[model samples]
Target: MDDLAVAIGLVLVIEGLLWALAPRMGRRLLEAASETPESSLRLAGTLAVAAGVLIVWIARG
Candidate 1:
């Protein structure tokens, strides 16, 4: 859908800005994330999904 494509594009733009402006910090964050436990990452990802859904639902309403 068009909305999904725009959302993906926005994510890419935000991520690109981080790497472009602070490559070192981005690399360090990646390293930290790699060292983080799988369970923590999974929980964080789940929370992010829930939050995103809630935001969209509220915005649409």
Candidate 2:
């Protein structure tokens, strides 16, 4: 859908800006993320998805 495409595009733009403006910090953050536990990552990802859904639902309403 068009909305999904736009959401993906926005995510890319934001991520690209962070990498372009602060590649060093981005790399370090990734490195730290890599060392993080799978459980923690899963929990974080789940929370992010829930939050995103809530945001979209409210916005649409």
Candidate 3:
């Protein structure tokens, strides 16, 4: 639970920094994402999750 909280917090900080530093880019990205197909988005999300799990597993070991 604590690890999950920390991971969520880190994600928020990274996302916040991107928007803070590059607001226009962030907006453009969001717009692009909105127009992106759902299947593509889901595939990207699935890959991200798998990569994250792999990272955590390696880090823990």
Across 1-61, the per-residue lDDT of candidate 2 in tens digits comes to 9999999999999999998999999999999999999999999999999999999999998
The residue pairs in collision within model 3 are none
Using TM-score as the yardstick, the better of models 2 and 3 is 2
Q: lDDT tens string, model 3, 1-61?
A: 9999999999999999998999999999999999999999999999999999999999998
**Candidate 2 off by > 4 Å:** none
Instruction: Give the total clashing residue pairs for model 1.
Output: 0
RMSD of 3: 0.9
Model 2 local distance difference test score = 0.97
User: Could you tell me how far off, in angstroms, the CA of residue 7 lies in candidate 3 after the best superposition?
Assistant: 1.0
- By summed lDDT, the worst window of 10 consecutive residues in model 1 runs over 52-61
- 4-59: candidate 1 lDDT, tens digit per residue: 99999999999999999999999999999999999999999999999999999999
Residue 21 lDDT, candidate 2, scale 0-100: 100
**Once model 3 is optimally superposed onto the true structure by TM-score, how far is the C-alpha of residue 58 displaced, in angstroms?**
0.4
Error of 1 at 56 (Å): 0.8
